[model samples]
Target: MVVDDSAVVRGLIAKWLGDDPAVEVVATASNGEMALKNLAAADPEIVVLDIEMPVMDGLTALPKILEHSSEIQVLMSSTLTKRNAEISMRALSMGAADYVSKPESTREVTTSLSFQQELVGKVVNLAAARRLQKGGKVYKAGKSSSLNEDILPQVSSRGAIAKRKMSSTLPRIIGVGSSTGGPQALLKFLNSVKDELRLPILITQHMPPAFTNILAEHLARASGLPCKQAEDGDVIHTGHVYVAPGDYHMIVVNEGGKKIIRLNQDPPVNFCRPAVDPLFASLAGTFGSAVLGVILTGMGHDGLKGSQDIVDAGGTIIAQDEATSIVWGMPGAVSQAGLCSAVLPLDDIGAKVIDITTGEAL
Candidate 1:
């Protein structure tokens, strides 16, 4: 199944899916509501969804699909915009499995035989690994994530953690970079922490422009914090999470010892606008030993160099363990490079942050 407003996109994706011999393109829809209506007839094994549409958008439809067909696996697509990046992440939180960037234009759309074959292969692989639980019936298009409390790191659940406070009085900030399984994990982490967390937070979740506003709304609702896409020359503040918009690079600058946020229209870094490296690099320069870089679940190694930069600046770094990650590439790369101070699972990550940052447990 494919759900998109653009006929061109629908046709192209449907054509691409058709190329897979083992798979079938059962249905397509122009909006989320139509997609839901089609579900009874199509009974598709996998759904490729778009974020923007009339009547119902992908994020809203995501939870509905899970509620109706727990077996259905949805993969979202969006334009390469900051808003899209944020919304796509929110959809993932609501239970959509994975996502891909739509080719920004027809000219950029891959038509080469090799690229087509590779695209088909990636889709097939992802579809095969999806799984979900609905109405007590378990169905999977892919492997199910063993999200369990037992999998968390060795830490007491007594509501308080014992740790020594950092001796240095340097100002600290938290930098988070995520893609793939980010939205849900981020929401869970942020919401789990107490409101008294001290440092300002910066995030660069992989997404496009229009979706970012939607993402911010969802994150704000879930985490009880002000979340928005970063604007040029915006000042970084504590108790807020500033997400980098899609199609732009976000960097932190120091102006008389206060941190300032800057957005750049420069070419994408590591094939990603809002690439993790620039933000991390900026942190290395601005906060140095006072920065705590965290690499979460995502594909690719966008944050690797940035993590290295933070480490070189005498800052700390953390990575989500492979088991808790949907795609372990980013965190795995940072861990392999020996740049991570802690390699903890997703559930343990929030506690660790509270312990390290506030010098107290939540």
Candidate 2:
């Protein structure tokens, strides 16, 4: 279903999405109220919801839609603005699957082939993930860890993990990559810790400029840690969280014997700028065996090769298990490729990091 007040915008989006073979335009509505009225008939598995409308806004309609069905995935859409970006992130944290910044005008939307493809891609990927999740193992948070339910993942035949010895030197930098369910997952992971480990953490979450700024603030409040968007030439420091700004790949280089961040507008990898691959590659080069790469919930295999770099440099990789991820593509790719040393649930990752820093080996 598509929900927006503007008929032109809605029509354009519907046309763009309907052109894709994998997607079907089940319904279109002028407002959230209309969407809610016809939702059951349409039976939309995914909703492209606009943030602002006359009758009911996306934020107002979000929870109601979720209440109507737990399986429906809501993707927030809005023009590029700071306030809209903030609300988009909020919607994601509130259970929306993802968000896309809409074009400013009908003319722009007509010309933006990339935007059209991106919208189609997100919808298709989300639908495939949803299908994979049906009747699969579903592990809710706070479940009892009975022996059969929560045992340590063992060395499988793929054996990428078994090939490397644990790093002799403790990891000096923690590199994290996430998307989709990342905002809430990251908050939970950070809140699980309380200042025990003091390594400089560099994170690359798929978010835009103003949204990344808000996300950094949210991270600081959640973890009680210093968090900021990475700026070019900013010195990396212990006990601080540096997030990659949107559209820029954050890389590290040694200058004056100290590590600092460098941002670039290089072409996106895996359809994302500030991609996990570049950051992980840089972490592998700058910190070598002293790097710990973590792959969290995401839509694609953005971190697979970079995770290999982390492990090949004698560092380690940890991944969030599929049951706890919104979309397990990134983590699952590395896990299946045997690049990860430990594949644990989201709630367990923070504590695992602290343990590893305190001399525990994978």
Candidate 3:
């Protein structure tokens, strides 16, 4: 099943998946409601979901799909944006298997060159993983202790947490890379920390244009921090958050006496325009030991090389633990490569970041 409001998008996805002999383009819907209706009958083995649409969007349809058919694997199709990235991340938390970013929404059907290959591969693997009844186990990196649900710290309430002091004044930069389950995770982490956060934050979430502005607005509302799409010549300053825009690569470069943000429209690395490698690589070169690279819940290995870059530069790297991740591919890669400084669950990540930032631990 393919659920997208755009007829062109639906048709193009249908055509691409149709090429697989092991899979069939079972159904296509212009919106979530229609998709649900079709799903009631088709009982598709897998669903390709689009994040935005009229009348019951993907975010709303996500749980319904899982409730109606727990076995149905869903692969989300999302545009690049801070908000969409958040919603896509929400879908994953609600049980989406993985997601792909569609650069444009038009009848002419222009997409990133690797769109078909990447999307099809994710669908096939997701379908297989679901059929295997693995439950998030497909993303477990190189086998460790089989995780129990207790790995994630339980919060007493939505806004309840033990308060801790920001202890250190290290001149450091925070680099966060997320994909499928990033937005919600990011919000939770950012909001949990105090408004007077001390370090500068740089982010590369899989997203496209127009959405970054919306995301920054949303994050500002939630985290009380100034967040915006990083401009090419913008100066990097403490207490601010800079997000990598869609369709461009964001990197940090030092000029004169200060480090500034730089944007590039070059070809994608690891098939991602705002690939984590460029940002991490640049930070490794610029900040060296004064960087803390974090790879969070996401699909694929975009941040793996970046983790290596940070580690080699004498910086610390943190990976989100598998049980709390929407998809563990990115973090898993870093963990498997032994490039991590710590592996933590979602609830504990914020506290850990604060600890590292301030050099105080509770």
| Top candidate by lDDT | 2
Alpha-carbon runs more than 4 Å astray in model 2: 105-114, 132-168, 360-362
Listed per model in order, the count of residue pairs whose N, CA or C atoms clash below 3 Å is 24, 0, 5
User: Taking the tens digit of each residue's C-alpha lDDT, what string does model 2 give over 1-362?
Assistant: 99989888889889877876557899999999999998899999899999988988999999999999988989888887878887887788787888887888878877887777767767766766655545333223233121121111221233343323556778999999998778878787777755686788899998777688888877887678888999999999988889999889998888899999999999998878879999999999998999988898877778888999989898988999877887777887788887877888998999888878777664
How accurate locally is residue 361 in candidate 2, as Cα lDDT from 0 to 100?
Answer: 64
- From the highest lDDT down, the ranking of the candidates is 2, 3, 1
Instruction: Please say which candidate is ahead in TM-score: 1 or 3.
Output: 3
**Poorest 10 consecutive residues by lDDT, candidate 1:** 149-158
**Runs of candidate 3 exceeding 4 Å displacement:** 3-16, 22-45, 50-59, 66-122, 125-171, 194-196
Q: In candidate 3, where is summed lDDT lowest over 10 consecutive residues?
A: 147-156
- Please give the lDDT score for candidate 2: 0.81
**Which candidate would rank higher by lDDT, 1 or 3?**
3
lDDT of 2 at 172: 91
lDDT of 1 by residue, 240-322 (tens): 88888878889999887778999988888776888999999999998878888889977667898898888778777888886
Q: By lDDT, is 2 or 3 better?
A: 2
